[model samples]
Target: MPALSPLCLACAAALSVPGAAWAQAAPVTLKEVVVSGSRSERALDEVPASVDVLTGEDLDGAQVQDIRDLARELPNVSVKRAAQRFSGVSPGGTGRDGNAGFNVRGLEGNRVLLTVDGIRVPRELTSGVFGSASFGRDYYDLGLISRVEILRGASSALYGSDGLAGMVAMSTTEPAELLKAGQTFGGRVGLKLDSENDSRGVGLTLAGRPSDTLQWLGSVQVGRSSELDNQGTNTALNSTRTAPNPQKDEDVSVLGKLVFTPGGGQKHTITLEHVDKSSEVEAYTGRTTSATSGSVLDLDGTTDMRRSRLSWDGRFRIDSAWADELRATVGVQDSDSREVTHEQRTVSPTQRSRDVTYSEQLWQGVLQAEKTRALGGDWSQKLVYGADVTVSHMDNLVTGTGAPSYERYPLKRFPETRETTTALFVQSEFATDRWSVIPALRYDRFELKPRNDGLYPLDAASLSDSAFSPKLGVIFRPASNWSLFGNLAAGFRAPSPLQLNNYFENPFGNYRTIPNPDLKPETSQTLELGTRGSTHGFQWEAAVFNGRYKDFIEELVAVGGSMFTPADPLTYQAVNRGRVRLHGFELKGHYALGKATNLRVAFGQTQGKDTVTDRPLNSVNPAKLVVGLDHRLGDWKLGAALTHVAKKSTSDIDTSGTPNQFATPAYTTLDLSASWQVTPSTRLSAALRNVTDRKYWEWTNVRGIAAHSPVLDAYTAPGRSLALALVTEF
Candidate 1:
């Protein structure tokens, strides 16, 4: 209805070309049903928080294979993946730990909750000193996913711990999604290729309904790839080289589901899933310096990761006064990761090796009930209550050969530990003609128990903590097309076993890490205000939030101790800091030009600081702006997106670690995508990224690198690449 930005004007001009094919007229709308916001199906406009949804069609059209690629479409969301430059003795580098995790707002790692089908994913291994191994949390196959919902803000009132920042909920494909009316059997097969990583993959999915009450679905994916490409020019070996390391990777994933409806309003579904991935890397940069004697000849590393899950979900429609419907879910998941390093030495013509492994087995159950009733004329209320329990057993082992005399092999940094959490939550919403109010609360208790196997420390510590989270939201609608909302929410995170009982003693280095039994859980409070509306084929939302955190945990903080003392080495322990504040704002909207064309824009900026130290938080991402245009004609669709990222200034970076932190420069990139419906059941899509081939580095990928690093190009993003996919239904 009104004038737009220059980019939108350009897009409008392109859509008004003289000789353009015309397609059917369909009015554009933004009315999607979402469940993550309130644990019940509701229109996206009704949700008070900031939520984003991606459907299967969106994933297919974008050719997004990993979390890093998925971040490009969302504002204030990023995933970190560093180059592979780590070797023996330095195992926790970002290069070795790929796809670290999701960062929402300004918090990352365990602060963000990731789940699939209401089942929680395992946390990453984050032992700083005791265990030098870092394992990532990307363990899902994109081919099996049908929908993804990202809720940005505090979510502890509905979920519980580990919801300090936000939550990511993914739902797998079901048999009904693939089957048509009266069709008994249906499925699809897809093939994918990407030049950025030199990877090729294939996926096959099939669903069948043998009986009126029985249905089954099965899917499998397999892939192989080499190291990701970069703009580096040097190909020589050593730390000075800028080229990517030599690496090989393989991945396999399988999923199976069976749905049964015996009678009445009862439905049950059983699921089984497994994923395995492995990689081998040649770390030429880890070689000894040229001036050193008895220098290393060669270094190589191998890593393997695996996860398995079994789950059962049931829903019943019980028409009773107390409850209108009930749902129950029970699941078990196990994850394991192992890393090995081999070092070749020339002094004695000997070889050294290190092997480390970490595993977690979890069992969880949930029961929930929903009720809806009318209070008076034009007034109604809905209530949802749930209870959940989770138990996890985590263990780690380390063994090495040809180690230093002072250091021994087969040692455990922390004892085997078990973690348990029990929670109960209730949420209610009351609505009138022009206003709606929502209130929710949750109570949780967590405990950590450790069992000593007589490896490292005789007396380990156990931690027990409890917390309560509360949330309130209000919405006011003055007209049918516009609404304003405000929300106040609380969140918390329990300390992990590794952070409570990590113990290590290095005699030669005269340093040790001791456990902190009195560690406190992290907590936060968030206030958000926003308004969203749609009119004249245009939809938009603008929101700003301020979050305050307390008892922030810092790992491996140096305490008072002298390394010269033999009996008491320099002690490092996990400690809690004072206050932290994070504030940000986001603006996003999409406008439909006509029946076949649309233009969109999204922008986000965040700022955070440690109030106690008065230093800027390094976890906050730089400001970003993205604009896109899409058009469809007949059976073909074409789209283009432009992204601009602001520079990370030196004043914002914390220079405590590296005084000369490398600040990322401002950069802009453009991408083009097109899809063709070749046949009735076949579709082909391709994406060309970084059309300008401008070399640049992403702030998330190069946070800790020094300003004077010789191999800066290794941290650069892929210059130019292409991704292609083909899907066919049977």
Candidate 2:
């Protein structure tokens, strides 16, 4: 673990200036103000890490549409739900394989790293073994998010390589951000309803300034969905459905922004976005015939997505004197994923279809410089430097036909590729009074090239890698409410060009998929300890974390027998699995039982394994608790929430051999909410989720099937729901 140069990070940011003064220690005011974990702007406890923010009134009091409803309000997070897709089955990495999205602490599908507004969000790698790709293409539009920044641990120094399990930034909605100053032009309208997926939605917002150097904001959202019924208990596609199983989803979103300041104010911004989504399902082939195969299969699926982004930002307050905020960014993004499959059989009948599409096009750039001096008496120092770059291009295509057909068709399920990533970062903060210290560094480089034309069987290569991550943190505030913290970090992940050269073929299980141009890259090292406090009205936070992983890159299979079937096909490899051990504990609290009442609590626990087959490592998330209560009265506001889950007998599908290893009981759920203003611009809200219609399954939505298979595990999370909303503003 030695690698940190750039003149030792500019001589450690010039020895943090100095530190020998007194008087001038009064600062620590935060109710919020954070910017994606230290990319700038901080106040949320002076950002040392471990962050979670969701505003816009907490996404309108948790009516938040996706991101797995924030694993019931944070703690090791989760959001993996994408079921129903079978050929030889297994798309269980949750829908459209954005490649395992947002799993954070326990390690997300793509090891977490998603962003919008600050760019970076393009990852989906798969060579189809039925499906698996993750990293949030979760179809944005949390009502054009106004804020969402969640950073847990191990953030590759400062975002690089899937962030090694950390990062989820999403921002939109600005226009004098909660203006003041005789606001000019404004608008808002919203309507929503959901009764277990009979969904319907509409939203729009606009903001304006028109002068004083301009400002603008715009947003639009639309949604429709039907079919989300389950809890018929007997599980497995709701106990072999026969009818009433067609599903549908449609969505649309758009957002725009513009800002400028002109004066010594120095600022500029421009942003634009778009989102379109589609989802479909219809297939209850709960299987019942196939005795020597008399035929009785049926399946249907769809996942269509389109996303776009454009950005430009500039901020400067530098008239020289060593800089004090000079930031710049340029961006472009595009993502598209389309997967459709259909199969039908009725009794010795057959008809089939398949079409796969994946696309990504991205470009990004960033530059930053920040400075704050004054090192004598009353110590002070703040420095941040940055440089970032990303370039991407990926394409995959596969088409189909049936005798139960799929013998093949130009199958280049991810051959063409080009990737590039670059980064350089530095952070330093040294305060005085209460004491504070933070040191950070980052350096990254990644490149992959493969422009397969000969339809690849081999021969099309190039790879490059580099990484250096470091972080050290400390904060102590002996009194005045209190805080104590500690941290140590390093993270990494790389090796995806479809896992180092993917090649797959199955003219009917002859076996194939071997390409590991010596893959290696997956590392993490973490240590964290924390405490936070506030008096009287109460507020608290507690943390303990540990993580160490290396090499990690599982997936090994080579025919010759070990048959997990491809109809007699099996040949996959991508090794390098050595160490891994994660540990966790977290607690959160809040209390204000006086002026309007309030109380809340959160708890978490997780454990990991894989010290060479001692198994267990699916990010482990079990043992959780949440409790909340709220009341306001005056304008009406009320709330209640309870969540508890525990019981997961180790994973990798029950001890390394993953594939729906059954048994994952332990549940408790209840939620309720209310809000009303009903005048002064109007407002209304409601939410009710799983108020005891319990029957749950959340162990990262277990996935791996085929044991007595007839629909099998994971995908039973959504039973009992209701939500409503209405809003108007002028």
Candidate 1 has which clashing residue pairs, if any?
A: none
Total backbone collisions, model 1? 0
The number of clashing residue pairs in each candidate reads 0, 15
Q: After TM-score superposition, what is the CA distance of residue 357 in candidate 1 from its true location, in Å?
A: 1.1
Instruction: Give me candidate 1's TM-score against the actual structure.
Output: 0.94
Best by the TM-score measure: 1
Cand. 2 TM to true fold: 0.34
Off by over 4 Å in 1: 1-32, 90-92, 130-132, 289-291
Tens-digit lDDT track of model 2 for 27-138: 3332448887777777777666678787776788337765667556787787776554333133432344422467777777567788888887767454445353332457
- Residue 674, candidate 2: C-alpha displacement in angstroms: 26
